[model samples]
Target: MLRSLHLRAISPEAKKVGLAAFLSATAFAAVLGITAPAQAPVERSVAAPAAASPDSVELQLLGVNDLHGRLESPKAVRRETGGAPVDIGGVAALDAHLDRAERSHPGRTIRVHAGDMVGASPLLSSRFHDEPTVRAMNLMDFDVGTLGNHEFDEGGRELTRLLRGGQRSDGGQFKRDAAGRKANTSAPDFEGVDFPYIAANTVDREGRLGLPPTRVIERAGVKVGFIGVTTTATPNHVLDEYTERFEWLDISDTVNRQASELRRRGVEAIVVLAHSGAYDVNGDPGAAAGEIIDEAREMTGAVDVVIAGHTHSRLNTRVANSDGLGDKLVVEANSYGAAFDRVRLTLDLRSGDVTAKSADTPTTWNDEVAPDPAVAALVARYRAALGGMGERTVGRLAEGLERAGSLSEVAARAQRRLANADVAFVEGGNSRGSLAEGMVTYDELFEASSYEHQVMRMEMTGAGVRRVLEQQWEAEPDAPLHVAGPDEAALDDDATYVVAANALLMDQDQFTAFREYGRGVRPVGTDLEALEGWISSRGRETGVGG
Candidate 1:
C-alpha cells in the first residue's frame, strides 16, 4: 500500500468585489494520502474527486518544484505530524502520486512545476545532462514549468537546448556508457520537454523574452492563465558569462503586467509560478516570511494565487495583497520531490475568477506506496547505464576524515595540486558525507565533492592572499580556519603567487577579495576530478585523505 504523509492544508476565499483578496477561511477536505477515509494513492489507484457545483468547476494543480533529478531514492526521511519517522521522496513514488491525482481528477488535473526540475542533480540524472529527469517529467505529463537559478548553471545556450532539444552539449549521442552498454535508450529519445517552460522576467541579448510570459489553457470550460517568472537574484546564483546575455526584470512588476494582459484575454483565474519562495520562520504556514511575501503583497488583485520555488521551504498560507486583504494564496512544495502541493481551485463560471482555493502538502512515502513501474523501469535503465562508474575505486583514505573542518582542508589540498597553486581555499559544507578509512569508491568521493564546482587558479600577490584569508573571518569570525600555508613564514607582500579555490567562491560576492586582486584566473577542472586525482596519489597506490 502507498501513502502520502499530509503535512499542512489551508482553504482560502477571496472577496467577490476584487475577486482576488483572500476574504475568509473555510474548512476544506484535503486528501491526506493515508487515513483519509478514501483510497490511498497507490499504483493504478484513484483518489476521490473534488465535487463541483453547477456554476463552478473544480481543478487541481499537482505543484512540484526542485526535483533536482532524483530518479533513484534519495533515502531521506521526514517526521510525520506526530514525530513518527516516514520515508519520503523518490521519482517513482512521485510518479505514483501523480498517477493517483490524474486517475481521480482525469482531465481536471494539471501537473505543474515551478522550476529547478534539473541541475545540481544526483549522478544518475546529472550524468546525462538531466535528460532522465526531463523524460520522467514528460512521462508524468507535466503541463507547464518555469526556471530556477540552477537552470542557468551552464548559461542560456545550454538551457535553450535542454528546453527545446538539440545535440548533446558534448555533441555525442548517449548511445553507450564507457562499458559499451546501451544507455538512456528510452522512448522520447532525449529530444526535449513535452510541455512548455515559461519565464517572463528573463530577457535575452536580442532584447526579447526568453520564454513565453504566460500560457492559457482551457479546462472544464474555464481558461486558466499561468505566468512564469525567474527570481531577480538569479545572476548572483550563476556564473557571469552564461547569464550575461540575459537580464532579470522586476518580478512583481512583470507579474502584474502579465496578469493584466491575461485578464484582457479572459483569464480571470491566474496562477503566478514564481521561481521565488518564502521562508517558514515557524511551523505555522501563516508565519512564513521571505521576499516572495513582499512581492505577493505588492502584486495587484488580478493575480489570485502564487506558487514559489528557489528557497525550497513549505508555504501554504495566504498573504495580504496591495488592497490590505489576505487574498493571495502562496504555496511551495518542499524541494527534491520529497513532497508536493495539491492545489484545489474552484472557479465561478460566470465571473471566470477563482471563488475558493486551498492546498495540501503530501510527502512522498515510498514504503506506503508502490513505485510507478513505468518510471521504475526508466530508473533501472539509467542505473544500468551508470555502469560501474559509481563503484569504481578512486582511492583509499588514511583515516576517517571529519566533516566541515577536515573535508575542506582535504579538498583544498586537491585544489592546490589541480591548479598548481601555492594555496587552496575551499568553502565548508561542500560535502555532506565524510570519508572513512580504507578503500574509497568514486561514489563516496563524488558525494564528498558533489557540487560539480570547477577548480579555478588565480594569480595574486602574497599580501592579496593574506586578504583572502582575512575575508574568511568576515563571514565566520567565531572559529575561522585562518589557513596557514607552507610559504607563510617567507611570504612577501608584493610578490605574486598562484592561489586556487572553487570557482564559485572565487567569483561570488562574499569573496570580493578573491576577484579583486586575482589575475590570470581560469578553471582547472571539476572539484570531484581534483579530489579523485589527489586521493588516488596519496595513501597506498590508492591515496591519503583524512
Candidate 2:
C-alpha cells in the first residue's frame, strides 16, 4: 500500500485567487478528490493540493532551481534520503507530481518553474548538449522557465536551439513533435510547451529581440501574468561572454511595467519570478524581511507576488504591498527539488486584485510518497542507456582519505602544484565527501567537484594571503568553514601571490574576491582544467569496484 504525508495546504480563499489569476475563460472543473498520495506511501511527503471554494481557484506553482546534472542517485545521497527514499526529482517523478496535483485540484492547478533547468547536466544531457534535460522538462509539463546562467553557458544561439527544439547529431530517443506527429529522432523536448521563455530584464543591445518579455497563462476564467527576471548580478558572477549579447534590466522597473500591462489586460493576479537573491543593504542573510519588502515595494500596483532564487534561500515572508491594499508574498524553494513554496493568494473576484494570502515551504519527504513507477522506469531506461558509465571508475586512490576534514588538505596540495604558493587554500565546503581508496569514476569526481566550478588563478599579496588564512581559521571558529574579513589590516594591499579558483568563485561582487584581497590581484591559473587536461593526455583508464 502506498502511503502519503500531509504536507502544507493553503486556505480555501487563497486557491480562488490563484485560480482566478490563471484562468482566462469562464471554464473551470471542480472535482473533489485526493490531492496528495495516501499516508506513509514513501519516505518524503508528497505535496498536497490547495483547498478552495467553487468560486475560488487553485494555482499550484512547482519550482526547481540549480539541478546541476544529478541524473542518478548517489550512494551518499541515497543513504541520506533512506534506501527506499522517494526519489525526489528526476523528470519522470516531476511528471507524476504534476499529474497528481492537477488531477486532485482539477482546473485550478498550473505548473511553473523558477530556472536553472539545464546546463551542467550529467553525461546523459551534457554529452548530448543539454538537450535531453530540456526534453525531459518539456515532457514534465514546464509551462514556463526563466533563463538561468547555466542556460547561457553554451551562449545565445545554442540556447535558442534548445528553446526552439531541433535535431541532434546522433539521432534521438524518440520521434514525435508537440503535435504528436512523427519527427526527427534527434529533436529536443520543447514540443507541446506553448508557453514563452521570459526574461523581462534580458535584452538584445538593439532591443529588437530578447527573451520573451513575459508569459501570460489564462486558466479557469482569469488571466494570470508572469514576468521572469534573472539576476542582473549574473554577469558579475557568471562568464560575461555568454551573456554579452543581451543587457540585463532592473527587476523593479521591468516588473512594474509588465504588471501594469497585465492589469490593463484584466489579469487578475501578477507574479514575478526573479532569479535574484534577497539581501540587506549590507548584503547578508540577517537583513530584515522589511528590507526586502522595501527593496521591492515599488511594484505594489504592478505585481502581487515575487518568487526569488539565486541565493538558494527559503523565504516565506508576507509583507503589505506599497499600496497597502493587501499583503504581497515573497517565496522561494530551495534548490535540488529539496522543497517547494506554496503561496495562496485570495483575490477579489470583482477587483482582480489580491486580498489576502499565506505562504509556506512544503518539505518533500521522498519516503512518504511512492516513487511513481513510470518515472522510476524512465530513470531505469536512462541508467541502462548510460550502461556502466554511471559507475565506471576513472582512477584509483592510493589510500583511504578522510571525508570532510581532509578537503582543505587536498585543496592545499592541488594549489601548491598549480599555484606554487607558500600556502594553497580552498573553502572547506567546496570539497564535499571523502575520496575512497578504490576506483574513482566520473560520477565520483562530479560528486567531489559538483559545483560546476571553473578554476581561476589570481595574484594575492603575501599580506592579503595571510589575512585570508587568518580570517578562515579565526574569524568564525564556530562557523569555521565560512571565511570572513578581519577588523584590522594585517596584510598589505599591494603585495601579490598566485591563487587558483573556479570561474563561479572568481566573480568579485557575488563571491567577494576583491573584498577578500587587500590589493594586487591578477589571473594565475586553474587546478581543475589542469587536472582534466592531464587526465585526457594520459588517456586515463577506469575500473569497477576493484
Candidate 3:
C-alpha cells in the first residue's frame, strides 16, 4: 500500500531525499486519512510546520518503542488491512530500512528506541533473558534509549547487568576460551557499553545515581543532546520487588536538569526520548496524557524534539512550550514496529539552534518493503536457535475463540475454565493480542496471560461479582489502577466465592483493597477444593472453553 502510494506521489528522483522521509510523510498522511472518519464530529487537519531558518543542523532521528523483542514479524494483530498478515517486524528488516536511509545520507542517521525493549519478550530474546535484544540494539548502534516500564520486569539487578554489558546474564562471557587456558581463569572483560541507555526519571534511592540523563552525539559536525525519562507510573506495570529499591522522580524536573547540563556542555541541538505518551488536547475517551509533549514544552532551556511511547498512541504535532519558551516537536512511532518514525531536525550550526524541521510516522508494511537481509539473517538465526523452544506446546487449544469477539468474552471464558466461577471478572490486560486459527500453543497461551498473574480463585456471590465489576468500570483515566475484586470470598463475610488470577494482577493497586483482601494474600486452594471439584464434575472442554 505504501509503495503504490509512493509511486503515485513522487518520481524516482525524489527518492534521493531518503526513503525514510518519503515513507514517513506519506504514511502520516495515510493514517490521518484513515483515522479522520472515525474521529468525525471532531475534524482534525494536519498543520504545516513553520518555515525553517536558514542556519540549522539537519538531524534525522529514527525511533521505535515497545518492541518487546518481536525479532521476527508478528502474527496478524487484526484480520483486517488495519494490520498485516505478512511479517513486518524483525531487526534485519529494520536494519535494512535504516541502511536505505543511511545510503542516501550516510552517517547522518540517529537511530533510537523509546523503551520496553525486553520484557514480555518473544522466544528469541526471552530464552536468553533479553540479552539478544540488547545485543541487537548494540549492533544497530542505538545512539541513546530511554527506559520503559517493562525494563524492570526481571528486577533492577538484571537490567543493570544488561546495561553494563560486561558479561551475558545467560552465564556466557564475551570472551572465548583458549585450548591451553586454565579452567579457573576468567575471560577478558568486555568494555561496559558501546551505547548508552538513559533513564533520567529513574533514581537509585540506595545508590543515589540515576540512569544516565542524556548523551551528546556528534553527527555531521553537529552535537545533539538527548534526555531520557521512564514512565512515572511504572509501578502500575512492574513488580514491587524490582522498584522497591529506587525512587521515581518527577519527569519535568529530570528534563529540566538534563537539558540544562547538555547546554552547559555546549551541545546545541536537543531531543528528549521520553517513555511517556500523548493525548488529545481535550481529555476525551481517545485523549491520553501527552506527557512527552507536555514535559518538553514545560522544561526550560533549548529542547527541539520529543520522541514518545508507552501508551502506544500515534501522534504528529508541534506543541509550543506552555511557558512560552519555544516550540517543541513531538513525534511518536506506533508500537510493534508497525511504523517508522522520522524526525528531520535542521539546526543552525552558527547559532547552535534549530532553524527548520519536519518529523513523520510512516507505516511499515511488509508487503511494501522487503526485509533487510542482515536483519533477516539475525532473526533467522534466533528463530533457528530457538526453533525447538518455540515449538514446544504447553497446553491444548480446544476453545474456538475468534479475535473478533469482545475482549470481555475471552477473559470471562478463561476465568470460567480456570476458576469455575458462575460469573468471572476479567481485567483489561487479559487480552492484548489475538489468537490465530488452528491449535493454540503455549506461546499463544503465555501471550494471553503474559503478566506474571498467578492462578487466584476466591468464592463470591453473584451480587458480589456485579459489585466488583462496577468497580472495574469506575477506574479513572488519569489514576488508572488494576481490576478490583475480593481475593477470597469469605464464607464468614456472608459470601462463598472462588476467583482465579495471576499473582501479578492480585497485587495490583486496583484489586489490592477490593472488599478487604489485603496485599499479597490469596485464598487457599484447599478452601476452594469444592469449587474445583464441581468444575471437574462437568466434562472438561477445550479451546477458550466458550
lDDT of 1 by residue, 334-432 (tens): 788888888888999988889889887877776666665445555666665666777888677767776676767877887888888887787764554
- C-alpha lDDT of all candidate models, in order: 0.74, 0.54, 0.59
lDDT of 3 by residue, 200-288 (tens): 77888777344667878888778888888887888878767778887678888878888888888888688888888876456341233
Model 2 has how many clashing residue pairs? 37
Top candidate by lDDT: 1
- Which portions of model 1 show Cα errors greater than 4 Å? 1-50, 78-87, 169-189, 207-210, 395-406, 428-440, 470-492, 534-546
Predicted structure with the largest TM-score when compared to the true one: 1
When superposed on Cα atoms, how far off is each prediction in RMSD? 10.4, 11.2, 11.3
Q: Can you write out model 2's per-residue Cα lDDT over 1-546, one digit (the tens) per residue?
A: 011112323222123235453131112111212123455353334446555565566565555555554444333234354464344555444445445545544555556666776665555555445655654554455567777666676566666667765554333334332234654434343332334678887887745445677788766666668888877756754565666787777778878888777778778688877776553335433233442355467665657777777665667665566767665677776665565656655555556566556666655444435444323433444444444654755556555445466544454455444544434455554553456665566656545644445455566666656655555444333224322222234445565556555454444333353356624444454444333233333323421111
lDDT of 3: 0.59
Worst 10 residues of 2 by lDDT: 25-34
Candidate 3's error at 371, in angstroms?
3.6
Order of quality (TM-score): 1, 3, 2
> What TM-score would you give candidate 2 relative to the actual structure?
0.67
Clashes of each: 10, 37, 33
